[model samples]
Target: GKDKPTYNPKKERGDVVVVLNAAHVHLTHDKWNTKLYRWHTGYPGGLRSRTAREQWEADPTELIRNAVNGMLPKNKSREARLEKLKIFPESEHPFEGFPLVPFLPKPRLLQDRGLGWALPQHLALVRWCPPSLLLTPRGPGLGAAAQGFEPANPERYRFRLRTSPGLQGGAGRPVVGIEDLLTEEERRALAAAGQQGV
Candidate 1:
């Protein structure tokens, strides 16, 4: 009959130890919520269950330890082997006394910026103006208009609704209808009393 390997805390087993940075470990999908850990006490009706997220939040080190322990052989030395594994929430560890090597994780990029689709390279972001201000006759693009400040491709952000050049009364003046300069009553009286008896 084969005998179970006895666990020895002092004995150095030729096994590889892996220490993962819990913060850097990226879990995929809903595994954090769906994956569960079930354990039973030695007594009857002592079943217990916990989600990976719950286990992690409660004790991050325990989650990794449980996962790794389950994968190893269920031998007497399993507990001894698990003692070698270590998981840390941060990149730093207290094993500086030993010759420790660093593990570099690959950088992951977002597949999309969530803007739906690509915008033209010439596009410029313009600040929004309220519709009330836009409805005014002397709104942004009217006479003597100051172009709004823009970052990156300022020219592309120009407001093309500028008053037509023909609408200008003079070099820098906007055209004003004659009615604008006269009141309705004055205009009517002036028209009726025109020229002393021409």
Candidate 2:
């Protein structure tokens, strides 16, 4: 599988080997942009960062190797196995006798950034501030409202936190009131907009 931890022992079967392209494997969109590839020199304060976009541009094989390296157990056995692995950028791989079985792509975990839909407050938390900084107002509610960075956009990522009662119109689902959820300033802004809409 592309970018998946795997082992295919050709010696078990009668002299057959599988060679993977290791270059053209597709990474999920945005993963190749935001995901960081890191390394350390084992010295004091030594860390390196490389984006997937950069890796794909420089050497796609390196990206595949790094991804596979992370999956192997960190020990002498792993080192030996890793040394035997051969990755190439071109379409050809150096395995003969056994037919090359195409490595199927692995299903990606959705633990990435867009995983907000799993929770109500998750996506909503992005509206006012990140969860790490969520706090009660310092002085009054107005100060907290002022500190808010961005207006909550329900349309942005299908934000499904608390919203207006009539927000969806006639199914007549229990619509939460602005007074119940919003701060004074936020309620006033929403009210003003509704007036303008009218």
Candidate 3:
């Protein structure tokens, strides 16, 4: 077994996580009905309570915040770590100026839960290139003829894989529809971007 690492109060534990479309979060089984969120208003007989479903409908972002906060260790640095977690009820966020990477959950996990795929509609517009393709010279190497036809700015080229809303999985597999995969906000975003579905 490896040795236990020492705790460093000054060291940062992880990077900031920005979660979008928090309203679309799904609760397994009957958790939405059974789970309860209780709090007091700091007044006499000011106790208030609501079910997970009620709370989620009232404030979608709060569910994600509570979930993440519950998982963090109860320590002096808990508040600092919690602050790094940013959750948005809708898909729109103000972090466009920053270089952000799309985090895709494992296909198996989604498939197991019959959730299909969840991805931002704008991510399809992001320009990306394989490191090998970027490094390859326009010479008679692998696929040389194709390499010769290079754009002035290779990074400017965008690659998109469009999936039709009506598309279905293989035989006996679950029929994952656009309505199942994308939230209403994301669907609208896709429409604004001129893409049918992703």
lDDT against the true structure, per candidate, is 0.47, 0.46, 0.53
For candidate 3, give the lDDT: 0.53
Q: Write the per-residue lDDT of candidate 1 for residues 1-198, one digit (tens) a residue.
A: 022275445564544455745543333334566789998997899999997767777777776677788897777777777777777765467876777544322222223255656432211221222221111112223222233423344454343223222222224222233234334554444333322111
Worst 10 residues of 3 by lDDT: 132-141
Cα RMSD (Å) per model? 30.4, 20.5, 16.7
Tens digits of lDDT, candidate 2, 1-198 = 223345344221122223244454444324555789888988889898887767767776787678778897776555565666677765455565545544322222223255443333222222232222222222223234334344346475244323421223223222232243335664455434333332
Q: What TM-score against the true fold does each predicted structure earn?
A: 0.43, 0.40, 0.49
> In terms of TM-score, which candidate is stronger, 1 or 2?
1
Model 3 RMSD in Å is 16.7
TM-score of the candidate numbered 1?
0.43
Q: What's model 3's lDDT at 169?
A: 27
Error of 2 at 152 (Å): 24
Ranking of models by lDDT = 3, 1, 2
Lowest summed lDDT window (length 10), candidate 2: 10-19
Model 1 lDDT, full chain set = 0.47
Q: How close is candidate 3 to the true structure, as a TM-score?
A: 0.49
Kindly report which residue stretches of model 2 are placed more than 4 angstroms away from their true locations once superposed.
1-19, 42-45, 96-198
Please give the lDDT score at residue 18 for candidate 3: 89
